[model samples]
Target: MKFTDGFWLSRPGLTPRYAVEVDDIRVDERAGTMTVYASTTRIEHRGDTLNRALLTVTYSAPAEGVIRVRVQHHSGAVPVVPAFALAADPGFGPGIHVDDEQGILDAGGLSVRVHRTGGWQVDFERDGAPVTHSLARSVAHISGGEGTWMHEQLALGPGERIYGLGERFGALIKNGQTVDSWNADGGTSSEQSYKSIPFYLSSRGYGVLVDSPDHVSFEVGSEVNTRVQFSVPGETLDYHVIAGPTPKDVLRRYTGLTGRPARVPAWSFGLWLTTSFTASYDEGSVTEFIDGMAARDLPLSVFHFDCFWMREYQWTDFEWDPRTFPDPEGQLARLHDRGLRVSAWINPYIAQRSRLFDEARERGYLLRRTDGGVWQWDLWQAGMGIVDFTNPEAAEWYVAHLERLMAQGVDTFKTDFGERIPHEGVVWHDGSDPARMHNYYPFLYNEAVFRALERRYGVGEAVVFARSATVGSQQFPVHWGGDSDSTYLSMAESLRGGLSLALSGFGYWSHDIGGFEGTPDAGLFKRWLAFGLLSSHSRLHGSSSLRVPWAFDEEAVDITRQFTRLKMRLMPYLLGAAEQAHAEGIPMMRPMVLEFPDDRSGFDADAQYMLGDALLVAPVLSADGAVEYYLPEGEWTSLLDGSVQEGRRWVVESHDYDSIPARVRPGTVLPWGAVDDRPEYDWADGVTLRCFQLPDGYDAETTVPGADGTATAFRVRREGARIIASSSDARAAWSLQAGSATATADGAGTLTITIEDNR
Candidate 1:
């Protein structure tokens, strides 16, 4: 994708045709668009335009504060790929200001100015202040031995940092990186990502998303020091410029364009134990693991059966391997009887040995080659045929089996392995371009399964542990970091990936507790247990080893019990954060920069993140458990202990296996539940409202969601020396904790107390 040999020279065998000047402009008042025809050379006379291809660029707005620019070199090449599955928004075209030199089209607060003379440059301004610009030569159509490519480069400002190229793990700041927007199954160590979103937000309060599902390459300040360049392998290039003064605002608009994540169930916030992949596990093994967890007082809410649930070479058969699980219905019923929701592993693949494969091949439910034969691969399984999600009947045929499994007590599915979709010489049922459908395959696959679950179980009750994703796949809740090694480095990389994904508008993310590739040591397992339990979703899974807490050590079991109970007790606060994510598209697990954008320390603090708006969680990733995390200006208090630490500097601390650096931010009223073992309960009953240093003029409030789909609001404020606490229900017996003092709420649903030395 790199066409330049140096700053001033093009590469060999490359002919770059730059859009020098705008030749003509046609304004469409009805469509609210401005179309420009830019020729490679200045159109001086009638003979100057002979034998030349002019680029046609259209400027339009899909929503307020969003500007979409579509550039095409050849207009007759019809694209079979579907548009990157985005939600439509009919924007109120703000106004159009035209002059002799330039035309400024204002949409919401963002303005795109098209230069009518001199160099062909498009300048983007947010609220009349210059943010970024596409210089004359920055927009080009290149033709070479590598074929045709359309490229665009946006000016990068000083100290501008880029983030969110989909769950990336390399670095927090994407300044000197080369990222490709392609989905791959590479683990946490590589540049390849499971979720390669074609969007990125900058520190300068603007974001750009290349609206191409095909392979796109980005050189972030690498090829050129002052611009972020992206190229696609086609004659047409399209991108959207989103303006936000704040990082959260950018994500809000981005998710509005795509879709917001669905609200996950309350029970999904609890611990999940999975059958390790490739491990010899039968119903007895699963039962023993459950029994062991119960005996150790470890709280588990969901149990997942991995790929072996189906027989070998029959992945999408959807039938339990009767040799191991005789009476699968009875087995699931017994697990449900023990108050546990069940999940089974499924992928969008059907091996040829299975009966479903024969039916699908006959019904045209599988992806086919150009010669009319079904596409088959032997990577994950023998003769695996991918289900063509482009066809409606194919999706229905696939989901019908999932519905049957759910009817037999399955709660959710771990939709894995959409990254291995074929792109070369393939045909989609709906005639979508194979190259574009490669990365978008997961979106359709997960959507079909998610919608099926919602139809069966109702809203807020469906969840998928998906792995691969593209731009809009964040609508599916609970995507986990893919295959990782059982090492400290992998844990840190997993954190980086999750933090990046959170910024990319995914509300909930999880990772394998003790890694997924190999068995972790006892110390590593115990440490990862704490980190996993604190995530928005927690799961214990591995590739070749058992992920049961007792599989590591007795201390591991104790640590699992401790952190699992802590997360359960913190559900009142976590569920509220989830509700916020559903309403406004901010993530439950947030990067520190999202909360404190102006703080330089928070911008590079990838080791730690804010659990919500109120609590800071720094997972200790070192073998020695030594962590150095920064906190913004505040008076933070440890949720583990009542000890306080003044912020605005880095805090170096060492934690044991039982604890992490979890501190409550100032001006927070965190709600804690009484029941520590079970995740689903009346969250308002026996709830304790822990009021952290609520600076005198500020008020803190939280809503605790209960099992019956109702929530109670608890409010606390500090006025001078007296702290006032109020609840929505007068009969709710809740405790109020301010510093070291704890008092039960009075009968009037309000409690007033005076601190000795109120800040």
Candidate 2:
């Protein structure tokens, strides 16, 4: 991907055709496009244009505040499918003007100008100020023995940092990192990502999304030292530069272009206790775990069946293993009777021993090679053939099995193992290029299952605990951090991945509570319990052992109970956050940078995050519970205890399993739910408005999500030393709390509580 050895020398044996100068520029007003023909070599004399290639650079506006730039070497190359799905505004028309000096195109406060007499220069500006631009020799058509590549380099400003390449576990800042858009089943603590998004968000209030599903290599300040270079092996390179005055603005525009995360059900937010991969898959074992949680007063919501639910060496057949699960329908009914949802593990690969494999092979529902043979692999199963979701019949065939499971009362599915898609020696049913289908495969795989769930249930009620994701996979509800080992280090790494995914436009994210591949100690499990319960979604799962909290110690089970109940108590606030995610495309769990863009330390802080816009959650990464976090200048109050910590600096403290470094932002009217046993409840009824340091003359109105997916209005204001809270809905009761002072209203009334100053 790095063509130049340094700044001055090209990599040996690689042929580079740099776009030196623009020969002509053309504009089509109807299409809102500007095409610039740049000569590969500088035009000196009449003979200088004889035997030279020209690079065509096209500029257009997809939506407001978004500009698409496509650099092409050959215009006649065949088009490729399986690209990222973008929903461009149909009636958008950018203001185009070309003078003697430059050509300008403006769309919604963002503009791009192409210098007429410069050495192939294009400058992007916001509000008539410079953001980033392409300099001389930055656009090139690269060729070597590997293949042809279309390359583009954009300059990085001083002190500008990069973030978001999807589920990365390294440093939060992405400077000096070489990343590729290849999805792999790499565990936590590696450069390889399970969900690899071909996008990078700049701290300078902008983002760039490479519009390619094929392998894209990015050299971020690693090769050029001053610019981010990306290359794709093809004739054309298409990308979009989304303008943002803020990082949140950038994500809003980007997710609008791609799809936004769907609204999930309320029960999906509660604690999900799974039969870990090593647990017995019989009904007795399932009942024992479910009964154990209830006996210990641990609030359980969902019970998941892992891979052992199916017969060995057979997957994608969607049949319950008869030896263990003799009555799938009856078992699901029993779990539902206990007020618990059910999720099952599934993937798109069909093993040879699967009952549907031969039918799929005969019906062309599996990917075929160029030699007209089924492409088989033996990594996770015995001779598994990936289902060809590209074929309409194949997708229908695949969803038929899901419909059968839904009839058996499965509420959701864990779509796993999509990162192992083959990129070579394969042909898709729809004639999509194989390389492009590699990352795009997960999109199709998750979409088919998600749509099936939507059809069975309604929209906003379907859920999938998917592991692999692509650029547009955020439309699905939930995605989890994949394959983490059992350790404090892996716990921190999992947090890093979740934070990265939040920046990459995902709304809801979850991870294994006790880690995925190993058994954790009692302390680690208790620590992860606090972190997991605070997440947007919570689940207890492991690889080779049962993940029941009692498996660790009594303290572990107690910790599980306290945190799970705490999350349930916090449901009103969390459900409101989920509504923001569904409406604005913002994530429920946000990175610190998204909350505090002006704070320099926030860009580098990955150890903590803001749960919604109110509370900051710093998971205990050390066994001793020592955690250090940053807070801007404000009055910070702990959500766990009524203790307060002053902000504007670093604070380190040790907490027990009953507590965490969770603090509420100042002047926040946080909604505390009434029920602590189940997540689904009438939120407005019996709610408590916990006012945290309500500043003088503060007024804000917010909504609490209702059970039927509607929002109820709540208003709060601080006048003098009295803080008043009121709601219009007369069907429920509410309360107010300010600095140890508490008052309750019966139904549909106002609660006024006067705070004592320094009493």
Candidate 3:
């Protein structure tokens, strides 16, 4: 996608037509749009414009603090399908003005101004302060070897860092990297990604989203040292610029346009034990694993059956392998009786060897080629034909099978393998462009299943362990990191991907507890156990190997039990964060920069993240149990050991298997649940408000969500030396704890506690 060889030279066979100056600026009052027709070459004379190309640039306001820019070389080409589903307000009227010298379109606090007669340039400002701009020679159309592309480069401020190109496994900061917005099945160690969202957040309190499901390549300070360049094939390139005075504000506006993640179930946040992929598992082994956790005092919530649950090579048949589990219904009932939810693995493909494939092919529910033949591939499964989720009848047919599984006691699904969609020689049932549907297919596939789950289980109760995603796919609740090795390097890389995805507006994310590809060492497994259980969702899974705690060692089992119980106790705080994600777009597991935007030292801290708004979790990534992390300006109290650490500096801590850097932020009234056995219960019942280092005159309100979506508010304030806590809905028991002192309240009352050892 790079067209320039260096600073002043163009690559061979490349014809670059750069926008020189604006010739005409047209304002559409009703549409809230400003269209600028720019001559690709300088038009000094009237005859010079006769044969020159004119690039059309249009800017429109979609929502408050959001502006969409569309650049086109030829306007006659048909618009592409499978575009992002943007939520634009129709009645929003932007302030627009055009003059002979300059034109401006203001959308809320963000405005874009065009230089009418000067060298083609558009400056974007946040409340009259310059943020970025499309500078000279930054917009161009390049044609080479019968293919044309349109690209736009935006200026990057000094020390500005970019993040979130969708679950990236490389460095957390995206500076000096070339990223392509194409989904792939690449593992955690590679540059390719399973979820490639065409959006990036800046440390400078702004974000950009390229509006294309097709292949969009981005050169973040890579192609040009001072600009971020994005290009797409064919005539048009559309993108959105979101303004934010803070990273949280940027995500709020961005997710408002695409979609916010839904609220997942409470049990989904608990410890999940999965039958590892390609491992030897049946009713006996499964029962043994479930019973083993209980025997070891490990509080488990969900049990997942991986791909081998179905017959070999018959992925979408949705049938439990009779030879392995002749009674899936009764088996699932036994797990439910043990207080566990069930998740089954499924994909959007039908192997030809299965009976469902012929049925789907006959019913025209499979993707077809232009030659009128069914599209088949031998990648994951032999002769596997993808289910055409675009067709209404086809989606219904697919969901019918999922519904049947639901009837058999399946509570959720792990929607996998949507990244390998074929874009060549395939025809979509909805007549969408195949190239555009490549990345977008996952959205439709997961949507069909998620909507069905919601129909059956009700809203805020459905969950999916989906692996692939694109624009607007955050509406589906839970997604996990795909294939990863059982090494500390892969563990660190997976954290980078999850942190990146969290910044991309995803609320809930999970990964394999002990990695996915191979068996992890005891140290690695025990270390990852703390990290995984502390996530929004936790799952223990692997490939061809059991991820049971005993698979590593006895210490692993003890560590797993300890973290599982700890996570159960932290449900009240985590559930409140989930509710916030549903109401706004902020993620539960937040990057350091998102939580502390003013702390420049924490901008590049990816290994550690803020779990909800109170706790900071720094996972131990080394076998030696040594971890380095940065804390912003505050007094951080370790939730694990109750130790104190002063803020505003980097700290290295060595932890045992049962501990990590799980610290509570200063000035936080964290709601702690009394129960430590299960995730679902009366969350406000016996809740303890743990007040951490309350400075004088500090007051805040904290809310804890019930299992059934009910929320209760608790008011905490510090007056002199006493910390007082009061509840709004005190139908159940509550308490307040400051250091060693504790005070209790039965119902509709207030409790006060005094701290003796806050230091």
Candidate 4:
């Protein structure tokens, strides 16, 4: 994607056309836009523009402090489906100031100046200070042997760092990296990513998101040290620049433009066990594992059936394997009787021998080649044809099979493998451009299944364990990191991927507890058990080996039981955090920079993360259980024990398999539940308000989620010698820890307790 040889030379074969002089400018008051026509050759006189091509640049204000720019070489190419959602317009438009030498368009707090006499310079500013700009020869329409491309480059300020180009595992900071926005099946050790989002946030208080589903290549300080260049292989390049006084504001506005994350069900917050992929399993084996967990006092919530649940080579048929899973309905009923949900794995490809293949071929539900034959490949399965989600009947036909599984009592699905879509000489049913649908295929595929689930279950009860996603796919509830190996290194890499995805606006994320490729030893399994239970969603899965706790060691089973019960106890605090994420577009698990933006070290800290803006979780990554973490200036208390650690410095410590680094922030009123055996219960019935060490005049509030999907809220504040708790609902009970307190309540459901303050 890089075209320039150096600072002053172009590549040998590529021809570039630069917009030199503005020939004309038109303003559309009705559309709230400005259009400029610029010629490739400079026009010193009227005769100088005799024979040349002209480029068109259009600008509009999408929202307050946000500008959308579209550059076009040909004006006739209209994309079928744009990736991100469009912004809603306010009543008033921006202010425009034009002069002979320049023109300025002011939208809220952001301003862009278009030079009329310079070669090709556009400067962006905030309050009359330069933020970033495109200099001479920075905007070019490029052409090579294969096709044409539209390219744009913007200057990067000193000390500015880039973050969030999707679920990347290489480095948290994206400077000096060449990234392509294309989904792939690459594992955690490579540069390829399963979820490739065309958005990035800079530390310089701005964010840029390209509104294209075609392959976008970003050279972030790689080709040019002082510039970030992005190019797409097409006639038009459309993107938006979002301004922010803070990073959280930029994320909120960006997610508002795309879509906010949805709230998943409460039972999904507990520990989930899965039948290992590629391992042979029958009803007996599954029942034995479920019974073993119950016998050992491990709290289980969801049980997942992997790919082998269906017959081999017939992925999309949606029929359970008769030989292995002959009694799926009865088995699912038995599981539901035990208060556990069920999940099954599915993909978008149908094999040649599947029973529905001939019917789909006749009904035109499969993608066709240029010669009007069904496109087939043998990559993952023998002669597999991809279902065309762009077609309405095709999506309906695919969802009908899922409906059959729901009838059999399957609660959810693991929507996997939408990253390997085809684009070479293929045709879509809706006549959409195939090049663009390659990266956007997962959005359509996942949306079809998600809508089907929502139709069957009610609004807040639908959820999916999806693997691949694109721009607006956050509307679906949960996604997991794909294909990690069994090692300490892979565990850390998975955490890096989850942190990166959370920064990219995903609310809930999970990964395989003991990795996905091989069997983990007892040490790795116990360490991963603690980390997995602390995640937004927890699952135990592997590729060719069993992931049961007892398969490793006795201590592994104890660790699993211990952390699973701990997570069940922490559901009130976690569920309230999920509601905050759904409402504000922030994530439940946040990077250190998102919490403390002023600290420079926070920008680079990826080894630890903040869970729900209150507790800091640092997973043990070393085989010897060594961990080092940093905390901001505050009074910190351990949630595991009553031990306290001072803030504003780094501390190195070692832990056993029974514990992790979970610390609550100062002045936090954390909520806990009395029920420790199940994730689904009436949380407000016996809620315990575990108040951490609080300063005077400190106030905090949280919501308690119930088993029937209703929420009750409470507020607490500390005043000198007593803490006051107020709630309209009287279902909550208190367990005061910050003080030795005796409770006294008024008739209006308000209770005041005297603090012992033994510390």
Candidate 5:
């Protein structure tokens, strides 16, 4: 994707043609959008124009502060794969004007300038100052044999950092990296990512999203030290420049353009236990694990069955192996009786060994080769053919099988393995280009399954543990970091990837606790247990070995028990934060910078994160149980022991299995739910309101949702002698505990409380 040889010259056999001169400028008759047509070659005379190449430039404003510029070289070439922009109708914004004498096209506050009559240059300026510039040779139409590409170069500051290419495990800051927006099955150790988005937001508060689903190559301060370049192989290049004064504002605007993430169910925040892949598990084994957790006083919510639940090599058959699970219905009913949800593993590919494969082949539901036969491969399964989700009949057939499983007590699905789509010599039912469908296949596949789940289960109750995604895949909740090794290093990398994904408009994210490839040491397991319980969603899954707590050590069980109960008790506050994530585009598991944008110490702190806006969680990544984390200028109290610590300093401490670096910020009113054994109880009943150190005259409010999904707002304001608590909706039964706070109410949804400053 890098076409330049150092700073001055282009690589051999590559012709980069950039727009030089604007031949004409006009406004559309109806839409009134400005269009500028520029020629690639600068013609000297009238006779020299016949052989010169021309690239057309059409610039317009789709919305305020959003400019769309399309550059095309050959008009007769085939349309490119990976269609740009996923939204159905983005609507229109303001008008555009062309000032020929000034040599600039003004699109609202943004301006594009043409320099030297033929040497094309566009400068995006705000208040008569340049924020970013696209020079003459920066925008080029590239050609090499049958493949063509359009490249764009935008200015990058000297020390600005870039972030948010989806689910990347390499670095928290994406400087000096060559990233490819292509989905691959590479594990956590490699540069390849399962969720690759062609959008990056800089520290300077601007973001550029390449509107392509196909592969996009990005050189972030790599090919040129001062510019960030991206190229997509096609006839036209389209991109949007979004402006924000802060990174959170950029995300808000970006998600406004794309779609915001949907709200997941409240119970999904609880701990999930899985039958580890390839591990020997039967009805007895499942019961033992569940009973073991209950015996150890560990709270569990969801029980998942891995691939071995079905017969080997027949994954999509959707039937449990009779030998292992002879009575799946009764078993699931028993688990449900014990107040646990059930999830099963499934993928889109149907193996030849499955009986449904022939039915699909006869129905023309599988992707076909050029010769009109089913495309089969032996990569994961023998003669496995991918379900052609482009075909409506195929989607219906796939959903029918899943609906049968849902009839048998399956609640959710682990929609896995959409990254290995084949792109060569294949055909799609809807006539979509195969190369474009390669990355977009996951979107269609997950949407089909998710919509089917919603049809059976009601809305706000459907969830999927998906692995891969495209632009608009944020609509599907709860994607996990895929395929990591069992080590502390991999745990840190998983956090980095999850934080990156959250920054990319994903509301909820999870990961394999204690990794998925190998059996982690006891230290890693206990550490990961605390980290997983603090996540938006928690699951214990692995390969080869069991992820049962007792397998590691007795302390691991205690660690899991304490954190699981803590998360269950914190559901009132967590679910409120989740509601905010659904309302705004901010992430629940936020990076440090998102919470503390003014704090310079938090910009590079990837090892820790702010759970919502109040709590800071720094998982210990070392074997010694030692962690060094920083808090911004405030008073932070330990959520585990209620010990107070001052901010603006690095604190190093050793912790046992029952404790880690978890703190609640000051001026926080956290609601502790009544039930710790189940997550579906009425959270507002018997809610123990815990108030942290409140600065003088500061006010905080906590809203607790009732069983009917309606929330009651508890307003608390602190004054000199007393604190006042009031309710807006109804008279909710509540109590205040901790810090010697005494309460008295007047029956008009108002209460006055006084607290002594004991601290």
Candidate 6:
């Protein structure tokens, strides 16, 4: 995708054409838009402008603070126009002004100044301060022998860092990196990503989303030292410039344009145990693992069956392999009787070895080759044919298979491997261009299965462990960082990827607890166990070895048990945050910058994150169990030892296997369910509300979500030495306990107490 050899000339077999001069600048005040026409060929006279080639740039506002710029040459339209469309409020119309003398047209905060007979530049600003600018010869419509590309260069300021290219694992800062917005199954070690979104936010408080489902290549300060350049293969390129005063605001505006993530169930927040991929397992193996965890007092909620549950070369048949799982229905009944939910692995690909493949082939439900035959590839499975999600019947067929599994006691699906879609010499059922279908395939595939589950179970109960996603795939509840090696370095990278994805509008994310590629050492496993249990979704999975706690060491089991129970006891607090995620477009797991935008220490603090604006989690990333985390301006209290740590300073600490670094911010009313062993229960029953470091005159409120997603709010305030608690819903009962201080409410539905001491 790199065009230039060095800086002076294009590489071999490449031709570069750039827009040089603006021949004409026309502003239509009535329509509130402007158009600048620039030609690669110089305009000699008025007669020469008739058929001469020109790059037409049009600027318009789709929303109050959103500006869309489209550059085009030919009139031919793209084959597959994506389903993404901007939704905006019409009441706040854009403010447009045109200065003919200065050749500047300003639309809201975006301004474009074109030198009438000289070079053209477009600058986007907020409060008259430049965020990014496109200089002369930066916008180009290039044509090689058989390919056409449109390129643009945006200015990058010093000390500015770019982030959020969709589930990237490389670095927290994307400077000096070349990224491609193409989905690939390259695992977590390489630059390729499973969910590649063409959106990036800069620390300079601005973001750009290239509005294309097709492949987009970005050279972030790499191709040019101080410029972020992106190009796509087409005659036209459309992008949006979103303005924000902070990084979090940029994400709010971005998710407002793209879809926000759906809120997952509260039970999904607990620790999940999976039958590791390719591990030898049967009902006996599963029962032993479950019983072992129970014996160790480790709280486990959801148990997942990996791909081996199905017969070899017959993945996604949606049937439990009779050879190993002879009585899957009864086994699942037994697990449920023991109070556990079940999740099974599934994908959209139908292998030819599967019994349903012939039926699909005969019914024309699979993707077809140019000669009207089914397209088959022998990558993950033998003669696998991808289910054509573009076909309604194919989607129905896929859902029918999942429905059968659901009927057999499957609660959710580990939907995997939609990234390896074929784009060459293939035809879609809806006649969509194959090139665009490569990235969009995951959206339709996950949506089909998710909708089926939602139809069976009501809303707020359906969830999927999805891997690949596109622009709008945030509609799915949970996705995990894919295929990581078992190491400390890989664990840090996985956190980076999750933080990046959360910034991209995903509310919940997960990863393999002990890493997905290899058998982790005991130290790594214990550390990863703590990190995974604290995430929005937790699962223990691996490639070669079993991920049971005892498989690593005895200390691993202890660490896993401690964190699992801690997460289960914290469900009341976490689910309230989940409700907020559904209401607003915020994430349950937030980067430090999202919550503390004014704190300069938070801009690069990827090592720690705020779990829903209250509890801060800093995972032990090294074998020594040493951690250095920052606490913003607050009187933070440790969740483990109940010790207080002052804010606005760095704290260095060492932890054992039984504890990790977790703290609650000041004035936080964290609701805890009475039951510490199970995640899903009457969250409102016997809720023990804990108040942490309530400052004088500070007020806090907590909401407990019912099974139906309705919440009951409880408000509490501190005045001088007295504390008052009240609830709008009188039927709800609550208790307060912080450290040694405990207060119980009478039947009057309000509690009043005077603190004897600041214990």
The CA lDDT of each predicted structure is 0.89, 0.90, 0.91, 0.85, 0.82, 0.83
Please give, for residues 1-759, the per-residue lDDT of candidate 3 as tens digits: 688999788899988899999999998987789999999888889999998889999999999899899999998987779888999988787899898889999999899999987798899999989889999889999898879999999999999999999999999999999999999999999999889999999998899999999999999999899999999999998999999989999999999999999988788888889999999999999999998999989998999999999999787799889999999999999888889999999999999998899999999999999998899989889999999998999999999999999999999999998998989998998899999999999999999999999999998789999999998999997999999999999999999999999989898899998899988888889999999999999999999999999978999988988888888889899888887788799999999999999999999998999999889999999989889999899899999778999999999999888899999999888889989989988989999988888899988888877765577888889888888888868578898888888899997788877666553
lDDT score, candidate 4, position 160: 83
TM-score of each: 0.98, 0.99, 0.99, 0.96, 0.95, 0.94
The CA lDDT at 385 in model 5 is: 97
Best by lDDT: 3
Clashing pairs in 3: none
Model 2 deviation from the true structure expressed as Cα RMSD, one decimal place: 1.1
Comparing candidate 1 with candidate 5, which one achieves the higher TM-score? 1
* Model 5 lDDT tens row, 1-759: 899897778888787777777777766746635566777777778876787677776666666555667777777766754464444234654455556543454545555554535467777765456768887678888887668799989988766778888899988888889999899999998999899888888777777888888778999888988888999888877787776657787777677777777778777888899999998899899999999999988888899999989999886788899998999999999998998999999999999999889999999999999899999998998899999998999999899989989999999999998998888899888888887787888889888988988889888889999999977777887799999999999999999999888777787899999999999999889999999999999999999899989999998988888888889888888888888777787888999877877777778888999999999999999988889988888789898888888998778888876788889888887788877877778888767667787777868777887768788788877787566777765445676654666453322367666667623
lDDT winner between 1 and 2, please give it: 2
Judge candidate 1 at residue 747 and give its lDDT. 32
Candidate 1 off by > 4 Å: 43-46, 746-748, 757-759
Clashing pairs in 5: 20-118
* lDDT by residue (tens digit), candidate 2, 467-546: 99899999987999999999999999999999888889999999999899889999999999999999999999999898
- Poorest 10 consecutive residues by lDDT, candidate 1: 85-94
Better candidate number, 1 or 3, judged by TM-score: 3
Candidate 2, which ten residues in sequence have the lowest lDDT sum?
750-759
Model 5 regions lying over 4 Å from their true place = 41-48, 77-85, 88-91, 101-119, 125-130, 728-731, 737-749, 753-759
Residue range 524-599, candidate 1, lDDT tens digits: 9988888898899999999988998877778898898888999989988888889878878899999988888888
TM-score of 2: 0.99
Q: What ordering of candidates by lDDT runs from best to worst?
A: 3, 2, 1, 4, 6, 5
Clashing pairs in 2: none
- Error of model 5, residue 301, in angstroms: 1.0
